[model samples]
Target: MRIVVTGGMGDLGSRVVRLLVEQGHEAVPASRRTGLDLTTGAGLEAALAGADALVHCADDPSQGDFVTVYGTRRLADAAAARGVHLVHVSIVGIDDHPMAYYRRKLRAEQGIQAAGGPATVLRATQFHSLTAFFARTLTKGPVTFTVGDTAFQPVDTDFVAARLAELALGPRPTAYARATDVAGPDVLSLVEVARLVRAHRGASAPRAIRVPPVGRLMHAYAESRTVPPPGSADVGGRTFAEWLATQPARLTGR
Candidate 1:
């Protein structure tokens, strides 16, 4: 399989590239670093030529319109033209979520499906690093200012990347495949997550302020609206605590 991974240098995409290569596939990293600017379609023609599949991981959540929505549509079209299979990565609850970022992700999904190509969309829950970062970042001297009651199903990026590689390398005989989801083994409260961070990082036990949800976006998280459904695929064997145990003892530098 000749796979072109957009944003292949990114955290998740880089792992995808490495695994694909280790499995005897040619993993071409298509990103700004490789002279393929997805936002403006620069260097796409040469990069995508003869590619068997495209793993769409390049996203700019801050610039959702120009970079994510429009950019993804462009990538889909190019892949369609080149007879390449397109596998799109997305979040679990973006379809009905209230956040602007989620709305954009929904648009990107819709646009890619209609953009004329063989496509598969894989929506995943929050990454462990993202959920844990709340604890990792908020633990100032003694106070960890955070939204107290929010819950998260934090999956490992390595698991997410493995699933993507499978989809990218698998057969795509149709114009579009039904979207699937993947999640972590367990869900944890924000405060519980904070405790784990404090224990591992050797940070001061935070004064832990329990601020209630204020906005629709925050409220959505509090209610577990972004978690995967009951029947969705759960691909990891390691729990959050187990994974955390193997991480570096030093706190990640903020």
Candidate 2:
């Protein structure tokens, strides 16, 4: 099978491409690096030619809703024209949310459904990398600012990618793949998370400041939006602690 992966150079996209190639499938990596600009539709004709299936993983930074919604519509139309199957990766709870990004994702899903092509929409929880990135970015010297009481179910990128590849090969099903309730094996407040990270690195303790709107969102997430129930079939492995343990050691710049 010839599989084309958009945003193939991205963190998740690269994993999908590698998985497909390892599975003995013809994997075409289409990204800006490969001269395939998904936002502009450049090189799409050549990139998608002869593609049996596609994993649409393209993302626009700065919350470009139009690019994500409309760009995906174009991609779906092109896939339909080529008679190729599509596997769309989206965030969990998108269908129930009114957020701009989530709304755009819903529109993308609708576009794919309207394309009249075989399609599978896989909505996954946040990635562990995203959580880690947030953790690192929110830290300032010895203080970490965070949305207090927020919950997250962050799955491993590799697991998500593998599941995507499996979905790409299997029959189309509107299935949702969630990650383990990834709260470091414990549900801790933002302050607790900051403390844990500081203790893990043997660094000085940091103060955790909870902001307002973000904290409200976090509270909502903790209430019901995030954290899957135990033994849920949709959830997969690697508790947050396990995921953190797997992270590569940091290097001090010389």
Candidate 3:
């Protein structure tokens, strides 16, 4: 099978591409770097040409809806027209979330559903790297700030990439369908995350300072909206601590 992965050179997309190649599939990556610009739908038809499956991993939240929303819709429509199976990666708990990015992601999903094509939407929790970055950002020196009972079940990126590759290789649905959510094995509070991060760097655990959830976005996280309910998702991945151990002692950018 010939698979086209949008943003194929990106962190997640690259992993998916590698997995697909390992399975003996022809994997093609399409992005602006390769003359395939999703924001303007340029080179979309050419990218999808002869594509048996397409993994939608390209997204730029910083560009607002240009890439996250319209770009996704454009790709979905084109794939549907070409009778190609579209596999899209999404975030969990986007429904009813106040964050702008999450809202746009939900809109992207709706667009894919309305595209009337064979598509699969896989919603996973935050990746481990992002979770660590959050912990580092919320910690200042020896004090770690927390909002309400905010916690995370950060999934491993490798696990997500493998799943996307499997979905691309699996049977295509007649229309848009959602697969079971995926997540990490354990849920850790904000303070717990901070402690693990500090431990990884051989630093003392930061003093946790609990703060009120003052805004919609903070409140959503306080309620653990990003975490799928127990038994609601297919959880399989390295624990956050396990993943952290494999990383450099001094963490860098997300």
Name the candidate that leads on lDDT. Answer: 3
lDDT of 1 by residue, 1-254 (tens): 78999989999899999999999999999888889887789999988988999999998877759878999999989988777899999998776689888899888988888887899999898888787886667656666666646677888888989999999988795886755688889888776777787878786556768678888876786677887767776657467888888888765632
Question: Scored by Cα lDDT, where does model 2 land?
Answer: 0.70
Between 1 and 3, whose TM-score is larger? Answer: 3
lDDT of 3 by residue, 1-254 (tens): 99999999999999999999999999999999988998899999889989999999999989999999999999999999999999999999999999999999999999999999999999999999999999999999999999998999999999999999999999999999999999999999989999999999899999999999988888998899999998999999899999999999999999
lDDT of 2 by residue, 112-193 (tens): 7887777777777667666556566678888787654555666777777888888787665442222222222334445554
Clashing residue pairs in candidate 3, if any?
A: none
Q: lDDT (CA) for every model shown?
A: 0.83, 0.70, 0.95
Q: Pick the candidate with the highest TM-score.
A: 3
Query: Which segments of candidate 2 are over 4 A away from where they belong?
Result: 139-148, 172-189, 204-233, 248-254
RMSD per candidate (Å) reads 2.1, 4.1, 0.6
Reference-based TM-score, model 3? 0.99
* lDDT of candidate 1 at residue 106, scale 0 to 100: 88
Clashes per candidate (backbone, < 3 Å): 0, 0, 0
Q: Which runs in model 3 stand beyond 4 Å of their true positions?
A: none
lDDT score for candidate 3 against the true structure: 0.95
Decoy 2 TM-score against native: 0.80
